[model samples]
Target chain A: MNPFAQKKIFLEALQALRLKKKPKETATKTDASVCPSCKESFSKNALEKSLFVCPDCGHHFSISAQTRLDMLLDAKSVRFLNRRLQGGNPLNFPSYEAKLAALRSETGIYEAVVTAVGKIGGVKVVVCVLDSRFLMGSMGTAVGEKITRAVEYATHARLPIIIFSASGGARMQEGILSLFQMAKTAAALERHADAGLLYISFLTHPTTGGVTASFASLGDVILAEPRALIGFAGPRVIEQTIRQTLPDGFQRSEYLLEHGFVDAIIPRGEMREAISRLLALHGRTTA
Target chain B: MTTPKPRTAADRVALARNPLRPSVTDYIDHLFTGFFELCGDRRQAEDASILGGLAFYKGTPVTVIGHRKGKTLEENLRMNFGMSSPEGYRKAQRLMRQAEKFKRPIITFIDTPGAYPGIEAEARGQGEAIASCLALMSRLTVPTIAVVTGEGGSGGALALGVADRIFMLENAVFSVLSPEGFATILWKDASRSQEAAEIMRLTAQDLLTLGVIDGIIHEPPNGAHEEPASVYLALDAVLTRELSVLCAQSGDALRKSRYKKLRAIGNRKEAL
Candidate 1:
């Protein structure tokens, strides 16, 4: 073929590929009932009923920390801990205080992780859930202190500890103090483990960075919600660093399970029962 | 690479990141002997970015840990440009624990832009690893010395920096964040790093004035790269003097001194 003709053919193929990729994205945007993953449409009521998991493809949707607490804990059994503490900007980074205040007002939460003593399947446990909605669940001083205290509390009460993790890693606004939490929380977890207490960590959608590396990975029985993204570096950054395409379903819950990083991949609906079973298996009595 | 006079913090930062600068291996080769490298975090893969092992500093057994930035582009890629992951910090922790068990002193070299910021790093708990290192170092029974050879950036630097004594090369820069990061976060433009560098007080002199570093090892006018032998000698003399003084103290006394030293920092002027 002539050079111009060859160039024209390549351009047309590129255009065709671009055209093929747009519809799924536009479809999700156009219809509120459609899921971005699997490109399947469902009624709003159906999605709400399924706990936002795609009925067809098992795509787990992100839920608020409160929703997770409600889903896992027994009816009206949660007693919040460390509710009065707030993060102070020790580094005095600009806009951090205001951003935190805005997030506080918007999320109605003082910090990212919520620690509570709650009942799961009538079993008493200290529960902590990280809300990704607040500051992408980036850990700071308050989050670290809250988690450490919760673990210590669990250790003291001789109760099983369960934490649901979803985070973007450490908060940059807090500087070194933000990174310090990673150590503090892990150290507390170590002390908790030393007391022979059972700790279960649930890796939710998009658990990455410092949160994944610490207490989340330190769980005696690590569980992940189906299709949740879990890794240290994000896929994009990894791709850029290595200059290669990652394998299919890389860093997903299934992939982690295969690599021995995760024990099981349970669906959102199964989480309550699965956790209950694990707690019971660990000899925690459920009355 | 020939370094300029480095009057400004940005200039010092450039010198710190210069490819020709003398690194951890160079110091180990010149100042220590019978160096045997130990690898792995025991829980994961060995991290090449952190060079850690047992070595003899002037016939005194010590655990040496330092960030390793590669000299070549290919090496840099392999070493992640000395930006450690959780594994690196864990490996350091393992070595520190070993040092504690053997009653050996610990010496660390700080020379990295920062810890690796990737999803995998986060997922593996980068913050937790660094944090554990800080806690471990703070409570360690052995005498510890940290040398800021170049860019001691962020918590990654502080992870290895909790010690009885901390020294910085005259041209080194240490801070809570990089100049570019500070500029981007504060001014909304990374190009304003020169301005940010001025305001952050991250240079060796600034750190000394602010009581962040115990002392400054004066580098040659052309920098450590151009005068490796002299730089090695200066570092050796200080290490010997400090180690001798530190070794004389009892373990409990050493721990108390370290705690006091760390706590006393950032409170110098306020107390005055």
Candidate 2:
């Protein structure tokens, strides 16, 4: 079976485990998520305490952008930027707008990325975090513009920037115009780099394609979450192109770090601390 | 000439990929003089897929780089059928730096399906190389122009195409991915590419309308392959006029205007 197909079964099994672990008192369906790795079930409150990392097996369950913001920034210090920006159906692809609307109401997010600026270890930084549940965190026009604007905000603000990327790639519904977003975001980053500002890219599970080939790779320091799949092409695409089943653990974060593409593989529990420590070292640039 | 009728997106796709279509090698002898070929990324082996060198266009020195897709099967394998690898982009980056250092205008011809998707490419940082090229191309101080001669597939094409002025031939197509890939990914049906192509808005005219390109260079009826001379003449005139106009601007002005062009794409509404 394909790795992803196997993952589907594990996901179903994990859901069943979540139900079983729910306590009789105040045990709601939304109150627990089971780890697919260790098959260990934990209450949502417990998972929040662990920063969504499974304490038993150390598997990182992907977190939402809101959770990420709260984890990275100080409580009540989070100030969102460009939350009103959304994408129209430029290509007029059938049902794309309707799909976006459905995802919006379901996810309670305006777009795939949440651009914000807040204190991390008491030092302000701009961030654009992608949540995969919403359209697999694709880089559509809105996502690109938000990231570009955030980077631009950082350049002028002289603040550090961080992006937690977990995208499937560029959105297909927007067609060719979706591709231009790559160029747009990268240009903003180029200008930011020209200004000698610090930009950190944190790659999460299954970041690939346009996202991988653009800003995610342009970071001055590129970091990935443990076991995250990071590459330009998806593993299935690679296997189909080469007509071979990939070796175990191919395209994982360990493979990338070993190849020198990633600076380090950071686990979820330590991500905020790691980012803040790096920020402390770089400091704020005067120029 | 027959009355020009609109071509279907799939028709343009086939026409752009027509093996008989004129490649970069066909245009060089017709457009430039004293072409001296440069090689290597300086960090690794030289990439044949990306052909970069110094040349004199209309007696003015300039840097010329292109994704060289070979015509024949054996030649295609030799050039990886214009599917550039990490080294190919690095090679382009080196050439771009050289062009900036010497104050020469940078012109690139894009005609790649996309970056080479293979295990080795993944191991060597294909994403990093393509990203580096995109970032560097955006900031180059010299006047930079890119023309899509054929397939401008995804980041591989965009890596070479971030320029002050971008254009495409009448029949060329540029997109986020091939329609086949799109269909397969979206609908799990590769055979529906013709349907996918219809909505992709990848044709040159579509790109021009969307403001993804500055303009479209007209090709001869029945495609540029049938009669190459007219296409060359038209492209030559466009380049000569654009190169002269861009070259006259100061470095700061060129950089500012180019940055504006990059920022302006997909910004037609506040919604995006």
Candidate 3:
């Protein structure tokens, strides 16, 4: 067997051995937990088929970047732009390099994002998917560079651009350099806009901090995934500083839509169709 | 006349002796004659932060684009604290293009803290939005004038600030980054914002001397926020005078002048 396959088999056998040793502990009675919004009990197989959404309640849980890419684009259609781009330990922050290595292994993706230039329902687009599993998809140099290059490609090709954002905020490890990415990305987007190309933004779960204040909010049509937390600062920090209770659904996608921050709120299942329709409406199609 | 006391907590307490500033609506009503507010970018939903429309300044037709910060909580939320998203800049670009096509002079009132910072904003290409505005303004044929009415922060301010004549209110400040942000980045403590502010050279007078601004439109003795009507009248006079000079130039001349004006900023001659 190949090394990867050998490793996988070894891991599976080790897990089986552990399970055998802890059979009594693993066989403990399970407590039923249902999604409060959807009133659907969690099932591993059902959730897998349903994109981790509650089948009964339709509550969309956070999804990984790869899963999102697979769900949005045509089967095997994604052509990622810069797969080789990687982050370095710029600040030499203790354990930062090791953390990145760990994240890379866990997520099976380089950097915080993977940008693809591909067709979604025959419409040409530059799509960037932020992997929340990797340091919460922070905007580091690699992430920012990938985004800038994607915009440049879209602008040059006169194709519409769409980016799915799911980030905790700017990477704290890179510090001021990470903050500079905001201006850099903004400058690039400005060039795309001048080219008269359409750019759409899809904000996903738990988007906050510096990312919220810069390029993420600059879409021609700003759409938020259902229940995504979109804001400059998290509610906990804001409340702690303000010394007051926040309103219900503060920074939630629905609240933002009502408050005019988001152009639309789209469910996970319908997002691809919605984006395709928008692309068609804008005449941004290759086929 | 003796200069007003330096802005401080004590000064602010003393200034409380005066009344609060006039609302943006009130200022516009008093200054703009035959004003008509335009809505939407015609491609997307209307952005409340960027207020664009046609207005008459002393009987001369001019297009007005202003960053508006509302007063109450509802209004503030609506205006997004005068921080525009991509659509806001797009709306301004639309208006500016229309103004150029119609041969009308363009006047912009800048007060935004910065462009809106959010994931949706980035995903939508906020950087492209601001850059597009800058590129469009750079090559615009019509006479363009920008007045810094309040806080002019970062690329948001620059999006509407590429003009033949850029004016600043006495109390207004313009900088590449906010003082608090610079302080936090440079000193690792946001509380040193006052020191950062002084070092940033962002005051209207400082910018005027640096040639980043064309002229300083004197605000009320207290500030524009205190007596907006007086500030607006002063702005009206300066804009009228600047517009006449800008209107006389041809398209090529306008583009060249603007290019020169921008290129001149931050250029220092070496001493041999």
How well does candidate 2 reproduce the true complex, by DockQ? 0.72
Candidate 2, which segments miss by more than 4 Å at Cα?
A1-32, A284-287, B1-5
Best by DockQ: 2
Chain B TM-score of every predicted model? 0.96, 0.97, 0.90
lDDT of 3 by residue, A1-287 (tens): 24344333323333443354321122122444467686767644345445556767777777777667766776556788988777565444458789888988887888888999777887778899888888888886778778878988999999899988889776766543454455456656766887888999899987766566556877899998888888765565456545777777767888778767789998765677789889888983568
Better candidate by DockQ, 1 or 3: 1
Candidate 1: interface RMSD in Å? 5.8
Model 3 misplaced regions, further than 4 Å = A1-41, A284-287, B1-272
Per-prediction TM-score, chain A only? 0.85, 0.87, 0.85
Candidate 3 lDDT, B111-213, residue by residue in tens: 7767776645544546557756766776788888888766777667777887888887777777655666656655688887676666655677667665567
lDDT by residue (A1-287, candidate 2, tens digit) is 24343333333333434454432233345657889988888876556545677868889899888777766676557799999789888888889888999999998898999999999878999989999988999998889989999999999998889999999998888888789899888989988988989999999998999999999999899999999989998888889888999888888999999999999988865676789789989984587
Kindly give the number of clashing pairs for every candidate: 17, 0, 24
Predicted candidate 2 versus true structure: per-residue lDDT over B1-272, tens digit per residue? 57767778999999999989888878887898988999998887888889999999988899999998897788899899999999999999999999999999998999999999999899999999998898898888899989999999888999899999999999999999989999998899999999999988999888888888988889887899999999999999999999989989998898788878777778887226
**TM-score versus the correct structure, for each prediction:** 0.75, 0.93, 0.53
